[model samples]
Target chain A: MALWRVPLDAEQIDVTLGIVHIIKERCKGCGYCIEFCPKEVLEFSKEFNQKGYHPPRVKKPDDCVNCHYCEIICPEFAIYSIEAEQEQANP
Target chain B: MTIAQEAIREATSHPLDDLLRTERIPHIWCPGCGIGTAFSSCLIAMKESGIDLEKTVMVSGIGCSGRGAGYVKLDSYHTTHGRAIPFATGMKLANTDLNVVVFSGDGDLFAIGGNHFIHAARRNVDITVVCVNNFNYGMTGGQAAATTPHLAKTTTTPLGNPESPFNLPLLAYAAGASYVARWTTLHARDLTTAIQEALANPGFSFVEVLAPCPINYGRRNKEKPLDTLRLFQDKSIIKNNAHPTELDVDWEKGVVLGTFVNNPRPCSTDMYDKTCRLEEKPEKKTAA
Candidate 1:
């Protein structure tokens, strides 16, 4: 069991954050990520990525529990979850 | 399954019947899938456990094995794939009194959920996990799962699986699963006992059920449900891990069958709560 800990705190006002992105190229379409997420945040995209596998696109970013079920179940090392970037409105 | 059958013994309190969610019947599984047999076995264990119904929380991830949590009528949650243990951990920590359990499949537990499996075992969380191994993943057209034997024929591996399969129980034992045992559905009587023991044990308890997927793996191997079970009875040579020489047998064609290991450790929560104490609740003042 590989445990990856994101040793950071949540920052407010994150816009278009790159929290988690699918690698599409290596995905085997196992659907483990869609099946295991505590939050129904991921869905199989209608469009197939360059890899020819239907990768999961984040449908609801706020719902993620970050429990890491997706990162663990991905046999192909396709999905990587990271902290969302902080977005600030210009004063 | 087994636990639910225990309900029959009373015939009066109807207490066991109360423990089952009647609405969830007519479960979706292929005929002759050992999951059903294993399910009944689980039911009997819960019935005999004498534990309070409300306190037992069955948390499960996806796949056929995930259905094990739903069969029981308790504070149950059919959680997402490979997430049952963490959900179970949360449930246990939130209450600390409930008997948290994870009923899941090999693909859910060892493949995608493998990391959580080890951490849960290492933490020695106060929970019981029963992983049903049917070799291949039967739910998805019999694809080769992590539990499938190397070179076994599966849908994805039409030629045969080139990857090595897991020694599920050994992995658990290594990661500090305090109470660990492996039993084939053929050893239903033995399995019932292991479940009983796991329910009672303090720390993380794991039991691997070597069950059959007749429609999937069995079809290729040309075996019926009982035939697969009979193999466990006739050929399995594993007894005590240290005393293999006592039994004479060919190693390849046979799988080990029994309640192999049973060790108890201090509950993980007990240790965690000892140092990191949460602040006490403040008293609310009554309106003057």
Candidate 2:
């Protein structure tokens, strides 16, 4: 790696995996992901959770990285990272 | 072609059909991986460009997103971790006739390759870039990437991220990208159109597709593919006579998504192309 030699034609990643997960049921419609992700990935949704709180929704799935931070920090363990890609790769 | 028709075209290409790069099949990407979408968009852009496929080359770095060059059958240079841009640049400067495109990731671009991203945008090279922005590093397990959300959990950050993220479009626009547009994979047709426009537009055209990485980073955020798709449909704001602050605008159901930037004063590569003192730069002088 050149340490720093990105070309003009580099792919512009619009969606990516991030570090946080939001528990829809316990989200309380807090715009944390929207306010947090540097890439502007998360957004608030109209749908409410079991507690009648509108949870934060991921607007970009293709960009997520399953960091599991969203689950750990949430007061509620609503958001948790799963090994979706691992299954596809092995199976 | 319309998306439905495009699907037909997609079906026509039998598995392991035409040879462009290497004979790589069933690309080893995750199900619901945005990298696949980014790769497909690149093909759409190249097809729209009408550039000779034999004369075109694709480059990539390391990461789940870096596999583009190998997946699509084309003249691809699967380079090092984050040097895809430089590799593609070398290819272009050496042989301008060859359409050089780089497929990279947020971690590759924003983290390790950040400096390259700025310089390349400033140089205004003649190439079309399609970047997928998923907040974290998807390939090497989940980690806190440059684009990770603040106060979020990551493999590294057990508690939560205490930092902020980058505004990519603003960064690209400020860096002097000749053509810069933003869209999400949810808007597949519009995304294809943006890719087409970026490829056709001369100078450094950057199209950032907000894609989904349902497997790696998404699961951490509790986002399944269907839920993520619905989120895209809800959160996107269509491009029109929208307000500047409209970028920060929120919607009730889905987002108002559409083309944001199309044309602006282009920072021409004509000056550099002429200064290089070479015509069509000749392919691979000595072959690496």
Candidate 3:
């Protein structure tokens, strides 16, 4: 991603990376996380869970900024995100 | 496996698992119902408030939202219908140190329990009341409730609701509540912050949470759950400190959402101790 107006200290800044986690069985497929995620990182999965609902899948995993919007917005508490480790960020 | 897939595989528990009754993995609320969102926000606020969890108690009345008490891992009371406030008031009076929070639905809080709400606020009880207004009695087959919007369709009001809904914030302010606010389930961040403020306020506090009742209220109103959330996102005007009278639940005209009141007053316990306690008089005499 290229910044339209790069800051003087751009090299010093490290954009946080996050990994999305989905608990399939707990999801009721409300689509709240998908609809409200700022990064547009999630999409409905093709496979259904035990309850016969399609849980969300991380489509653009690297795009996530660890906002936790999906976690707070999920009524079912099915999705969350945690910050990526240093090795994972480079890898 | 990709990083996201690896994370999902390694996920053992949610951060909120410690605060919730995890055994009840899936709650009873239906798909697209907003109660769970509001409930989760309340829990998040409780966690963020930095209060002593051991001294806090959650009280709830009978309704769909009333089930909140059962899900929280705390000293919670699932009180009788419309009696959550009174029960909470009793607990507050008995142990002034406890942080009492009443979580109930529009039907439970305003319909049968309406009087209790006003009286508690009027007396300035030191408690936080979270009322989830879904515009109808969702659990009871979507019956018309005290907070149901005017002319809306419900199970009982099939043709259209004839009466107008109560402006909850205005009612709370009028009843002498010290802190009052309104927010929708879609505005989870603001709702959580407002609940935190309500919990910290020294006197009676009331926060009204507007949630979608898709299965019952929406089916008849021609609104899908997503549509209702979109409406909340687009139509809500967040004017902090807006007058209470302007905070009505009108979708077409737009809903006013914010903290309307935050002035502290002497709470009921403090006033009672000041005026009625006999032991305090001896201390005053000795000082003189």
Question: Residue by residue across B155-212, what tens digits does model 2's lDDT show?
Answer: 7777877887676666766677767777776555566777777776667777777777
Encode model 2's per-residue lDDT on A5-86: one tens digit a residue: 3556557743333333343433444343344343444677788766666766666654555643333222222344444445
Q: Give lDDT tens digits, candidate 3, residues B189-275.
A: 999999999999999999999999999999999999999998998899999999998988898999999999999999998898798
* Model 1 alpha-carbon drift over 4 Å, by segment: A1-91, B1-17, B241-253, B278-288
The number of the candidate with the highest lDDT is 3
Note the Cα lDDT for every prediction shown.
0.69, 0.62, 0.89
Cα lDDT, model 2, residue B93: 71
DockQ of each: 0.01, 0.02, 0.52
lDDT of 1 by residue, A3-33 (tens): 2233365455343333454666555564656
Which candidate do you rate higher for TM-score, 1 or 3? 3
lDDT of 3 at B12: 55
Which TM-score does chain B of candidate 2 obtain? Answer: 0.82
Tell me the interface RMSD of every candidate, in Å. Answer: 20.2, 16.9, 1.5
Give a tens-digit lDDT track for model 1, residues B18-41. Answer: 555646544566545667556666
